[model samples]
Target: MKSFLVGIVLGLFAFKCISSLYVKVLKPQSTKTGPERALLVAPGAYIKGEAYEPLGLQIRETCDFQLWVVLLLDFFDNIVNPLQLGEAVNKAIQSLKDEGFTDGSPVFLAGHSLGGTMVAMHGKNHYKDLSGVLLYAAYLTKGNKLSDYPVPVLTLSGDLDGLTRITRIMDTFQELYEDVSSNMKAKYRTPVLVMEGVNHGQFASGKMPSNVAEHDLPPDVTNVTAYQKIARYTCSFISNIASSSALSQQVLDEGFNTTFRLLEPLARVKALETNGFSHWTELAQKYIIELQNKTQISVRGIEENGQMIKFEFLFPKAEVHNSAVAITTYSLVTYPLDPFDVTLNPLSPIQIQAKMLSQERAKHVLPNGRYGAGNITCKDINQLSILEAFQNSSDVARERFSKRGRQIYLDEDQIVESSVQWQATQLRLSDGSDGLHVSSIKYKLPFDPIQESKSGLFYCALLSPFRAMEWIYVDSMRLKS
Candidate 1:
């Protein structure tokens, strides 16, 4: 027992010596140019600043910003207490100032995961001189108040990040937005970009944890592609901040709009990748055909009048009825080119209006097995309700539904073959056209089957829920003019 104790003590001492040597030998280095803006990046736990060398180089190549990579002492010290890491970063920043980094130029702080949280904490104290804060897969600790920070913040996270829950981050962002003063909110819009299908570690092109399997990690584009996307957004945000003349109300509004416009394509592509549609052509024919067949609408043509493109489709009439209950549904699905093909003209309008002719026939059955015709009206599905449903569904299930048009049955429902009547539904584009690439189909409940339980037709309605028409596969050439 005495010998074992000595061996354990010797092992710990050796590890400490090795770690101290590594820190001294591989201290963080700065990519110094005579650029006005400076970016100080803090690395995550058990990670060295060298891991982010490629990303740093990419950012510098794209923008006129100096990059400073700050190395912390060791993994244990940084993880157990981030204050030491923060102090090391402060020292690095001070060194850069001494090396002719002028106060006239702005400084931006950025980090990934735990490093992100560290910078957020550090920025709260050093907010006066910071142009902005950029966080990738940021994990917030208890009592961390992002609302107190005065600088603009841009947080990027992946949906498949096993380490951090995106919903919680979204909640925190909302709270921060609400807690800020109206004036501050106007100046610094706290934008959170949640990249679909990206995992926690992929944000940085570094050695990932060995315990995580490659297949279990979120699907990503090539490493170069992923880093390029991140770098572009980071450079754009910092550039906007450095170039802005004032935080006046009008300037703030314009700045926010411009920022979102630049970010729209990046967000759209990320969503498309998440839904298993990586390239533009892969999403072209199948997706367009699915929408047409599901809605039972034939595309008339696409008319381009200057900057606006008008799409016209024909909506056919249909009737559905049962002994005690009947319902008629009408819908139209539209697919525009912007979200799928970002290279297209940015001047394209976000939404194109569609005109649909709707008709409904509803009937109620009597207790004596007699059909009773009743007047019924079709109403649009609530947008909030659809959003709630999407949020409630699992990520994998949602991706399958989006990519393959597969329907997800409720947990209580048995996995037996089921049939549902197809209906014509209209697709409305929301304000933000970020995720509008996917086809949107809607079905209206013509009658409340639950209310008609006394009529003995409840089981029949329940078995066959409302759905779009069965799609018939057609040659891709048929869709062309």
Candidate 2:
């Protein structure tokens, strides 16, 4: 009788453990009502759904977004039956919809550790109605690469994700990135963020000491800072995807900046591979955390709409403590270049530009978690302001400019205005706290030319006084007469 009783107690414990993990769906406990957006999260293997509670709560406190986590009991879980998994996800989604979350609301899926893999598999297998996928501390198999994901995908992981190494992250991201078309690349550059001192388990809630999947390495970042960074990046990426705004092609240019130097790492896939990821992660743990800086800025993109050329610049902020440098001036400059098929230059390499887009000179200096925008227009007869001329260090680039300048009696050293009409305005989607201001400024150019001759390059040139001179290649002004 004693032995039978012991067996019953053991069985009860086993059932409780299974109950904690068996794909149970949980809504964040804060709100009785639904939110503007709904997020479904998956926790790592052997970890309960509660492991992701803190992330959900942190996200909930800032934005009106609902967070849910599901735990599936499997050993080293893989998305072998994605169709079945998709159905399970749909169940939770339907529950949200029933709670008045509705069909109009945007639904996002995030996964941590194995859960991260689940998110990718969902995207790969059935990306039907999803807005976007956020993979936290997750790596994708070649079979799971999101080459066909129609929406914006963020493959963010930590440098210290002991189980899901950054090397795998980079290798898989490059694989997926290169497979997409140029148009997709132009639209969504597939932003990747690797926070310093962060590891796999933190994306979920607690220490997760026994979850051996997350290598038992010491994370140097504090909980407040870590969650703040995760929530911040997640929000920004979602905002970008939802608005369908281009984050500037700065990553490909010489001046793209991220905390990890991914601006260049995106192209140099083999650099980290030379040494194992542990070496890289150990170094990244030493990086400092801050609140505000214009980490990314460039010409958003150039598009032709009827009689005008729409030119927009993307101004994105980074996490920091305070802002020291206030207003940075950027001159919107352009010069002619040859079309892709034929190699020819316009007669004059006249770098035409409108007046500089300067910040309002605020006390806080473009504060943390905010963007500034303003606009103005220039007519041909009103006389457009010459901010600065374009300069190329390459001998081949300089030779092309010099030859073209001589053909049209243009000065290589001066900013010359051609007969181009310009108009600028802005439409901002504002969201912030701490009484910070959000600014919107969009610059536009009418399809007016001295005459339509050849293709050109548009630039958001950081014309001096604040920092070193840098050219942000906005877009190739591929004109169609």
Candidate 3:
């Protein structure tokens, strides 16, 4: 009887303990008995005498969703080599795996600044178990290598950070993307996003700076006012590639009737500006106008005629002497329409045929999330079926995610853009937070004219947190056109 009583009490105590882990620590499913689900790595950028313990605790708390540890690199005292930093992350991950903490839940490798750079260069390749990697304010000193990482990488940067040249880093990523595409000979690539308004220090919520506007935050925009907004978007992004439902309802609404018009060809894609926004709408308008004015193409004009909807495009008459019918048709399809309606069916036979041809062209080119193709080529212009371009990097970024696999977030568009023969590089707007404003700017066209002409499309993707802040203009002309 005494033994039975003791056993019952012990069992109850164990149950209580399990309840605490789930209810308090694990929260959602502490009752399930299995290996610990996830792990988190912290940034040890300035870990010195007074900073170590508190920052370590901060990181552990930040990553409470999964089992986590802080890697105390001597970066503060001795600027460690990136390779060494990579190895340290590997060791820590291995330790967790050794402790039998490996289950189906994800193992996250995350870091800040230099630490973020380390993960991008080494984490997924060295630590195979990492499910997802979140890099905050990190630059790729060396471009990302290892094509078969089996992990998703989420790279976040601030619009106005000077410490890490975000634009240069983005350019480097494009180079890496090109290198990877050439080596793998693969059609698709991973995704990278430059989150606007986020500075380098805000990845963890508690340590946000006071001066900055609550909404205009770096990653740490987790004050009371922004918590709900922050958590919803952050969690959804982190949980997994967003469900189609999670996408902006407005964007999705616009997409229902629209088909995809891939920007570049197989293995040869163009650099897409994932972070540009504010001026993209205007640029789209300008491109449409140019197509209508400059080329003998059937450019559409969308307007609502009260109850009746009107979608009109003027096509060059099929006079054999004027131009080849196919050329004229192709020109019309590539031309952008003003205030285009995705739902409206093509009106004229020429428009219908152009739309069909555009759809067929899209089947061959790859898709990178952007609102409209900028600086497009004859080959790329000829190929697209859909006329629309993605508005946000996330649109393209999510496409590269892997399901039930190691790699979670990736977009290889940058890499493919590099291999093209006619590559163009332009100085872009810098976010204001960096304190260094671009009061003046300059870039000579034919950015990389010689090598870029071969592959058909030649363009550069300008990655800046403040890319959407202003109109991108050269001395006289707008850059997007």
TM-score of each: 0.46, 0.44, 0.36
lDDT digits (tens) for residues 1-481 of candidate 1: 9999999998887556444422211122355454467776766655665666677666766654564433334545434135355455555566666666665567777877777877777777778767788887783454655554578777766544545544345445455445544545433445555555566666655566442232123444566666666666676666666664333334334434443443333233223222322222122211222222223322222222221222122222223233222221111222334332111122112222222211121122222222223211111112222233344444543453456332322212111121122222222222121222123232233334564321111111111001110000001001111
> What tens digits encode model 2's per-residue C-alpha lDDT throughout 225-325?
77877876776666555553333233222111343353233223223112212111111111111212434222111111122243233221212134333
The residue pairs that clash in candidate 1, if any, are: 324-365, 330-424, 331-424, 331-425, 331-426, 332-425, 332-426
Model 3: lowest-lDDT 10 consecutive positions? 470-479
**Candidate 2 TM-score versus the reference:** 0.44
**Local distance difference test, candidate 3:** 0.32
- Summed backbone clashes in each candidate are 7, 12, 37
How much lDDT does each candidate structure score? 0.42, 0.42, 0.32
RMSD (Cα, Å) of model 1: 15.7
Better of 1 and 2 by TM-score: 1
TM-score of 1: 0.46
